[model samples]
Target: MTIQIKICGLSTPETIAASADAGASHIGFNFYPPSPRSVAPELASELAAITPRSLLKVGVFVNPDDTLLNEAVRHGALDAIQLHGKETPARVQEVKASFGLPVWKVLSVETDEDIAAADAYSSVADLILFDTKTPKGALPGGMGMGFDWSLLDAFDKSIPWGLAGGLNSENVADAIRATGAPLVDTSSGVESAPGVKDVDRIAAFCKAALDHD
Candidate 1:
């Protein structure tokens, strides 16, 4: 199967270009203010301007209100919406109806129950993203923490899905081998610091993900 890739939490034009050049299928812009990777709507627009149409621009938000989603969609020109917060299935439906964009609902997985929770959104969510659950009072995602890939073995695939959290060049191929993830996403894995993306790492990661058989 062909594997798709997403480089998340991108903030700069240089990294955005690098991601597209390296053959990424999707690029994410974080809109949550508390996270270090957060970007303003104007900055996201500037970065989106340089992005190629072949690549999808996904706006990442954490329990965002309509105001923030409105501004982000209008200014960022997002192609998809990734809900990385505690939004219910009803909220996911609301976001889809309001934005008229593909909605990817993130499920924080620690056990089979977490994986099973995706069923509630099978109807509304365009995509189901499995991520590692973070601690309370901490950032929701992009923390570079990975869970047991084996847990996904029990997943019923009731809907289309992708894998995220702690993926990088050195292990992305293995991740693909282990999980057969249709799409793989990463954020802090390609960063040199908290929110600083490393171009070379981005290239290597894309190469690894694409080269895997």
Candidate 2:
């Protein structure tokens, strides 16, 4: 089965190269400043420059406005925009229209009700991402928190979607099997520190996801 893997919150050249070399389908750059993985547009641009064109470059944002998206898209050379915040369906459409890029809205899930909320974004977003809901006063994502993957078994996945939050090499294949997620995203799972990605972990994650059948 060829599970698509996205290694998110990448900042350094070594990690970026590791993700690409490890056969990740997508690479993400964080634009949210509060997170340790966040990077400036210029720095993201430099990091993104080394990525091959075949690999999709994603820019992660938190309720971003036009200014932030524009700068990040231009400087980071993003291929897709991931809105990991409380963005309305209208906001998702607005971003798609404004940037003319594929927009991925994140659905923070804790209950079946949360998973069902994805329907509201069905027509607006090109893709939907299921991530663990962060605790109050905590950062939006990349917290290494996860919800019950079994909840997704009953979800009506009408739109293309992926899984995120707390996934690692050891458990990613199991997550995919439980949820049947075609795509899987990870950040802290492959990191040695808050913002530092471990190359070996990155490689292991890709191998594990791909080897899942």
Best model number under lDDT: 1
Model 2 lDDT tens row, 16-76:
8888788899999999999999999999889878888767999999999899999999999
For 134-195, candidate 1 gives per-residue lDDT tens digits of: 88888999999999999998887656899998899998999999988999999999999999
How far residue 147's Cα lies from its native spot in candidate 1, in Å, is 0.3
Model 1 lDDT at residue 89: 98
> Candidate 2 has what TM-score?
0.98
| Segments of candidate 2 deviating more than 4 angstroms | none
**Clashing residue pairs, candidate 2?**
none
Q: After superposition, how far is residue 19 of candidate 1 from its true place, in Å?
A: 0.3
